[model samples]
Target: MSENNTRVIVITSGKGGVGKTTTTANIGVALANMGEKVALIDADIGLRNLDLALGLENRIVYDIVDVVEGRAKLRQAMIKHKQSQNLALLPAAQTRDKSAVNPAQMRQLIEEIRAEGYTYIIIDCPAGIEQGFRNATAGATEAIVVTNPEMSSVRDADRIIGLLEAQDLRNPYLIVNRLRPKMVKSQDMLAVEDVQEVLGSNVKLLGIIPEDEVIITSTNKGEPASATEGSLAGQAYRNIARRLRGEEVPFLDLEERSGFFTRLKGLFGNKK
Candidate 1:
């Protein structure tokens, strides 16, 4: 198969439960909402949750495995979201393992999936450095590595960056998830800059996802946090989508700025 003019991206995390799938779903929805043809593929295989997070789990009749095996056509595996007209899902098969498919198979699948006019193809990869990860990044035009603001998570993200760099996935972007400005200011937790201090040199800072309860609540409700009104994290993801499209959106308010009162205090020799 031949490639199209579509941008295929892989959403990956070195560690588990670091919001890779959530990022995949939200960013996919945000892009589709912006009138782009998007398709979210569950490349996690057996342990797939991309469909559930997207609230289209029950709608899956075919999967990536099914497509590779030719049990059904590629179109038959895609489940369109009733809410987002341009957004469709290619779920993972629970009955299959990661070994069921390979990188070539994935490349072929995405090439065909893009034929349906999908402008953006986002693959939700499985955790760990295995064949699943290899297949997730087979022919990606770019990569978005997601990690939380923590030592363990950051460490894993660094390892992931190393692998991607070795693969030469140029211009891969990083998204610092669950950032808590208060904890960072108090020196209790890692800040967005801290994570960037480690991995940002290699990967561009795509966006910062703050630690918000709205994300959890929306996930349980089978809705993307970005869809909720005044959702900070949701808005952040939407901005990320726009940025991905080469749009220039202002930076979000992740940290509190120096107010007039704070500046006055500093000028009066009462800094802090």
Candidate 2:
């Protein structure tokens, strides 16, 4: 791919435990599965986990820090995905802190990867708005903010969107992860529209990933859920990848499997 066709996207969430890393892994894999050349960068520094998420931990001989420090070449630091030849991962240094690299170095690194002809470069940003976040967003042409359905996550996401806009990264897409339809039906969780209302209208809803056990199981096996079959969350990530490719794919209907009214009726009937 030419430099003009390359998209450098940063996946970020202001709060931790919001599936930002997982989103990066799955989305990279999903895009690669669709025949797009993808490069994933773990910009978390000391908290690096993208390598493990992609099951390339054991194969990592060099990391991003090594490349920036002039100890390793970019190609030497990148570990290719086992399943998809088009996918690769450039891991962070577990021994180093966020201050180890600067925004300029990150931009240079991304340019090197772009020169390698990658169609998409996905950066898994560290949680919080710190130097790590700045380093991750330095060369990103696009951004994806990952958040949950809770108030805390939404509030943090709003802040992140503002930060991105301040950096001239406007109209960042939103991905609401770990949504529970049953809880939403019982008025316990925020609905998609409710979350969007709090975030205002500019942030477009890219995808809605229902809470799935397969995510945990797949991660435990060091494999991303999107690379597996028969998983709702996996399919959701795939659909998001297609949408990223400019395809007009519809969002998944999360409540179709178990009707909320039927479950409510069953609960009341059992109480009699």
Candidate 3:
């Protein structure tokens, strides 16, 4: 396949526990559901968890390091999803550290996978700006900065955006995960606009995933929220997949569901 035919995207965050891995899993599954062949690479190395998130940990016989070090073929290390045949995972080697593979090797591995004809290659970058981050972004043609609706997360996301720009990955998209609408309405949390403002005008808002307990449950069950119905976070992820496919999808209305009078009072103010 031609290089233009495939999109290599790295999902990253400068801070940890911002739902970056979960976003990677759901986006991969969502794109696969849309009939696009997707390859997910867990680039965290020793601290790998994308396998567990995808529920394919037990099936991972070989990993990326195995492929990189010539111990296994690319296809041999790839673990195909049982439910979504279009989606496959190249898990990082838990026994190895980030030093096990370098940036050039990562680029080569991504190209090898690209030749396999996958439309989308999603790289789940390890948290922080370290060797792991460098390896993950080295092969990426695009980037998505995942963050939470908080001051620290936004600050870290801004730093990451700068790093991506420095690496020539311009116009990176943003996914504000774990946003609590009630908190936003109550002025306790930063709104999506606030995050965008902090990240600057260059970073575009890709999607907003409302805080949902279903995401935690789904991750624990080894099923991505995007694959399940009736999940707001899942719907948000699916929308992001659609957007990635060049479809214009409106952002989900994250306003808390409330009684008619309450909603009316929210829209209009309380009468003096």
Candidate 4:
């Protein structure tokens, strides 16, 4: 019942398709790569994709629902990652709904995992501000609110942050995902500073992930982008992981700098 040094982090988003599951998978892998013991829990219940993101879909036998129902032990339900010895995943039940597990059950499960001596546990929360979200965050010590660099995503993220604060979830950081620097320059998308302004002064901006095709390919291949060394999104996730570990890491510059041709054009008094 006593807690170890395990930090239970819930990765949530108020809206769907903002890369919450992907963020969770990568951060889990990044931490594991650093030699930290990590466990990823898919808290989405009926709709789960964290397993697929981690390439552990075929390894699932017992899920979180089974563990809560006393049908299986926690270790029996956990699937260890093939590539990382320190990384494991507790998949969600595809057939069960959010009501299948309550906050108390989730808290107890987290405690059991912590007692098992895991260093970090990342809970991949279901999208929307509903029962699934509540259940996902109940046992969390910290939170990572994932959002895209858009008006709707930012609005939902703000609402989610307020909800997290109401639940006494301290220091919930923000991750602006799927950002397009060219779009921002063309005045077609929201800038990072614009999002920061909308989220207000209290929220902390953790990191930003640029729109990269490599992420899409990685997801399709059931591999987390963070495990890929040359990926920009992977580098961003690794930086976020380092920041989460209390290390001072610089934010990734996703903006496209002016090239030689563009600067040459500007020198000719023709700025485009």
**Candidate No. with top TM-score:** 2
lDDT of 4 by residue, 1-90 (tens): 235678899998899999999999999999999889999999999998999999999999999999999999999999999998899999
TM-score of each model, in listed order:
0.91, 0.94, 0.93, 0.92
> Backbone clash tally for model 3?
0
- Report the error of model 2 at residue 52, Å: 1.2
User: lDDT per model, in order?
Assistant: 0.85, 0.91, 0.90, 0.88
Q: List the residue pairs that clash in candidate 2.
A: none
Candidate 1 backbone collisions, by pair: none
Poorly placed runs, candidate 2 (over 4 Å): 258-272
- Candidate ordering by TM-score (highest first): 2, 3, 4, 1
- Model 1 per-residue lDDT at 158: 88
Q: Per model, how many backbone clashes are there?
A: 0, 0, 0, 0
Give per-residue CA lDDT, model 3, range 1-272, as digits (tens): 56569999999999999999999999999999999999999999999999988999899899999999999999999999999999999999999999899999999999899999999999999999988889889999999999998888888988898899989999999999998888899989988998888778998899999888888899899999899666678888999999999999988777853346554553454221
- What is the C-alpha RMSD, rounded to one decimal, of candidate 2? 5.8
Could you tell me the TM-score of candidate 2?
0.94
**lDDT of residue 116 for candidate 1:** 78
